[model samples]
Target: MVKWDTLARPKEFGELGFLDTRAMNTVLLAKRTSHIDGCEDSPCIKILEKKKVLERNFFRTSHRGGSQFWQGLQEVKCWYERGRGCTVNCGERVKFRKDVWLGDCALKTSFPYLYQIYRERQCSVADAWERDWSLEFRRNLGQEEMVEWADLSGRLE
Candidate 1:
């Protein structure tokens, strides 16, 4: 009997590549997500944006009492944020700590201590730039922190 785990493995390793239902759902709903603002002529999108969901950060915004379709899209948005890292083409939309912009890893994941002390954790890259990369802390970093900062600073572009 073929093991269930083996059957679900990626196609690269000779196992059947099972369809990723969550990923598929995310893609299907992404149509509505993308059209939220860009297509200004859309009445539905305009209406939705007027409400609590889309006025600001759509990814970080909560969608507690929306319709099933909207709730599904919100879930997809959460999944996308959790599973992927982004390359910075423009600093406008990407969150400074939450995105993988500086180098290989997300700043939050790569530097938890710094993130904990960060004054502008939710700021975007553009926002950070406006503030002059001034990530404040309560006290001076210790020797280990200095080493870590040096390493990460070198890696940061």
Candidate 2:
């Protein structure tokens, strides 16, 4: 008898082209969680609402308590969060350094040294904008650092 692992392999690998059920389940759950924001009519969402699971942010909500399906949904939220990104509008809801608003990655990742010296790491986009983009740092920028700062400044504009 062929082992399940062999049966689950791709046809090109000289085995059956059946999908691994666990991996398929994970992919489906990730897909569901990724689109949960727009699926207001989903029965799973309704169940979460009935169970008071929608009281907090879906990504921030605890996965510790709920039905089997709810637990499964929560388990895939990390994948959802990783793939999701924010687009700044009002700016109040978007985090300046921690969120992926300005570019492909978070500002902290883009400018690690500047982020290290930044005073208000948790400040919102609105807070930084209101400050005229003159964010306070722990110390003055050195000559070499000034060049780096200029790059960051140019990106902001």
Candidate 3:
């Protein structure tokens, strides 16, 4: 079995790295059609859906003594909370720094490998020209030709 956790860390942390939900969702869709390996209707997908936490607009509280407390709300963008699909409130905001935020879903640190796999597969498909060319060249010429030109090429079967 593939170690998915190892695939979902930040690149600098030495893993494949985390990716946004849009890319992750694409991988889930393609997995249904057998395009990728290691994950298929996996538990991690459900875990991600169930535990998706969205950061919302921050409400800042300042004490009389100059101490500041930042409170983040659960964004109103979750489908379960809103009873709709892909609405603007689906938890896309995240506070990255003291007050700065990101307008995208950040996967929890635990599932970095799964996210990495998703990202890698999406990138590969998006850049399929080279992959397709290599596959075709191998099919037409020979395995020897493929070996000479490709770095790590091989058939699924």
Q: Whose TM-score is greatest here? A: 2
Model 2: weakest 10-residue lDDT segment is: 78-87
lDDT of 2 by residue, 15-114 (tens): 8889899888888988878666556778867877887888754755787977777888888776665656886878876778877787787888788777
Over 1-157, each residue of candidate 1 has an lDDT whose tens digit, in order, gives: 9766777789999989987676677788876665652455687666777765567656767868788887987877755565455655557778988876776668877877766666766788887666656556667887756766676666653
Candidate 2: what lDDT? 0.79
Q: Give the per-residue Cα lDDT of candidate 2 at 98.
A: 79
What pairs collide in candidate 1? none
TM-score of 2: 0.68
- List where candidate 1 sits over 4 angstroms from the true fold: 1-23, 30-47, 50-52, 83-90
Q: Over 4 Å off in model 3, which ranges?
A: 1-37, 53-126, 130-157
Report the poorest 10 consecutive residues by lDDT, candidate 1: 32-41
Cα RMSD, each candidate:
4.6, 3.7, 20.3
- Displacement of residue 102 (Cα, Å) in model 2 is 2.1
